[model samples]
Target chain A: MCATCGCGDDAGTRVSDLDGTVHDILPAAAAPHEHPHPHPHEHPHDHGHPHDHEHDHGHPRPQSPGTADAGHSPAAEGRTLISLEENLLAKNDLLAARNRGWLEGRGIQAFNVMSSPGAGKTTLLVRTIRELAGELVIGVIEGDQETSLDADRIRSTGRPVIQINTGAGCHLDAGMLQRALGALDPVPGSTLFIENVGNLVCPALFDLGESARVVVISVTEGDDKPQKYPHMFLAADLVIINKADLLPYVEFDVERCVRQARLLNPGVDVLTLSATTGDGMDGWLEWIRKNPHPAAAAAGSAPRSGGLRV
Target chain B: MHELSITQSLVEAVLDRTGGRSVTGVNLRIGPLSGVLPDAMRFCFEVVSADTPLAGATLTIDESEGRARCRSCRDEFVLEDMFLLCPCGSADVEVVSGRELQVTSVEVA
Candidate 1:
């Protein structure tokens, strides 16, 4: 646990390029020897749901008299309501905006590819790299729980790749992507693919400031996945139904999936492809080509802030 | 769940603004579409706020309604869940409210 930042063992997360260069993602706030608390792990074994005791904080205080909720108000019991109005994801959003600024400055179209495990994200990426090898200068930031295997696969294709092993983390945040960018240093006018950790839920909540978000689902999974995990589908700018080769054997309903996705995001585009057999690959590639880097238009100008720097 | 990490961020944001003041209540605006469960956050808050300036701070979650505006008719309707279709038989809908995950205020001594 980091005493300075309150970040936990997950702070040990790092970015590794194909050249074996490794960079620790988190700030060196707390060293291992400085574990002052009894529990060294970030999540303690105590699963006591203190939700019932939320109001009973052992301090008795009356509510504010009025409904004016913006400023500080002295309550009847002498406590002050100091309005903060701060977004919970502000920190991540700031980092994501910085990442957007950097990516936009270089005319690099970065796509955040997210999906459940075994949904063939890496397979599709590998196939894309192979198919677009001559036309595109592609770079990848592969995120996994703790493995360089996917990065190795991307490296085998001869493109620059960086692996971010998120230790015990369910998803990749903007800070991790920023650190990976520093190591990868992808060239300008290239396509940067950020393969997020294989989790549909947590990754949707985080904004990595990518040009677009692509959620991949395989036919082996339930067709109702879009409805089951609406947040993931809602965040997706493009939904790719992968593993089309197994569509004949599986019970996945492509129409229902597309309908569910469209219900959440009417503007979302859906593509069905079998990465292994190269079926429906043209549409996928065309979509990538059509959706150019969002930041490319703002190139040569001052970095556009996401309302962070006024 | 991811609520733990979110709660940690909430604690940090609150403590950052408090300036060493002992916080008594932390008010938040959480919407259903925010992809955050208030119950899970409440449980995580108790765990993350331990030994900090926000220790024992009452987490008051204000759940916002999920509302959306139809692009065709401009009629604002209540969106209960992920089914984002508008009542005007149109699929194009713009999210007006909901999806709020903000730390509105803090009660301090």
Candidate 2:
């Protein structure tokens, strides 16, 4: 472990209500269902819930298993060389694999929604939930650095939502997604949306085991976003050009943006929509409804009540 | 941004195999597909690892470019990103390497 192995100085993420009470979404075995459950301050020191850093992170560690190949590789001078061939993101990938398997076993379709902050991701989400929540068992794992504002907005939609305050993290890694998934078990065969932290680059590199990655780029932000942040567009399965209602007022060249996105990711599909005025939302909803497993559709029919399951 | 987290892993890796010895330097092989920029890694390593045992260790990187194979013509070439065209007029290609993000070795006293 690095001497700086602690999670952080910020509070762990909390699931809160639209009002003021912060709720902890615990598993059924952890405790009986209670509404507006206050957090237990699990990591009092803000040592973030970084599952990957749980290993011997603080001290100069002893010779690890990774050093076993040291004797094979040539050592020069008096320095004792250790051969540790390990990926920098091995831990995250490992957790992501587990998440993928878990979601597959449960037949849940997870989508990673990514975009810059205020690209109308939440607004698009609210509109989607309003249209599709009645048909499918939808859940959201909202990510933000600080406030529970997004979570509150999602909660008002009457769906299971967990706000993961990343503190200082720019992107949501797989381990965090795993924890959030445990907190939000949105039934088998349901659609789980992981609204990634608002960023373009970092989130592209970290995989959260999502079935598909949808990127949102509103017209007002810039038509050159795809050219500037190519990695995000390259990693996206579907790219949405949001806030098209402001197209007349904004000087965003939609065709050029799509061309740039295509240059980065030739296989990605593009869609335009305006969440504010209910324009082009049907296509987005149809895209969400088009791909779920047939069995998940049957499972969505189960008895549903109390939008917030306490 | 995410480099801080990745740098932590690098330092953690170094300290883990250090065996309580003073680390002099580290050898890393970062592939193009690894999505890690060398500059960002160096900057973050300096900031986040200052308090760790690997504080003074020089990070030596062996950068590798991304390689891809054309799906249609089976031609091999260097890849910058997902978007590329083969000399054989084929835009269809699959990545062969450059996604590596590894710590190959650590030097300690």
The best candidate in terms of lDDT: 1
The per-candidate count of clashes, in order, stands at 0, 7
Candidate 2 residue pairs in backbone clash:
A1-A56, A1-A57, A7-A47, A7-A48, A8-A46, A8-A48, B33-B98
lDDT of 1 by residue, A121-211 (tens): 9999999999999998999999998778899899999999999887767888777787778778999999999999999898888777788
lDDT string for model 2 (A231-301, tens) is 68867889999999999999999999998887666777899999999899888888887866534542321
Per-candidate TM-scores read 0.85, 0.80
TM-score of 2: 0.80
Which candidate number maximizes DockQ? 1
Docking class of 2: acceptable
Give lDDT: candidate 2, residue A59: 36
Write the residue-wise lDDT of candidate 2 on B1-109 in tens digits. 7777788767766665553455777788887666678989888878866756577787888887878898898889998664655678676676677767888888765
Residue A85 Cα positional deviation in candidate 2, in Å, after optimal superposition: 2.0
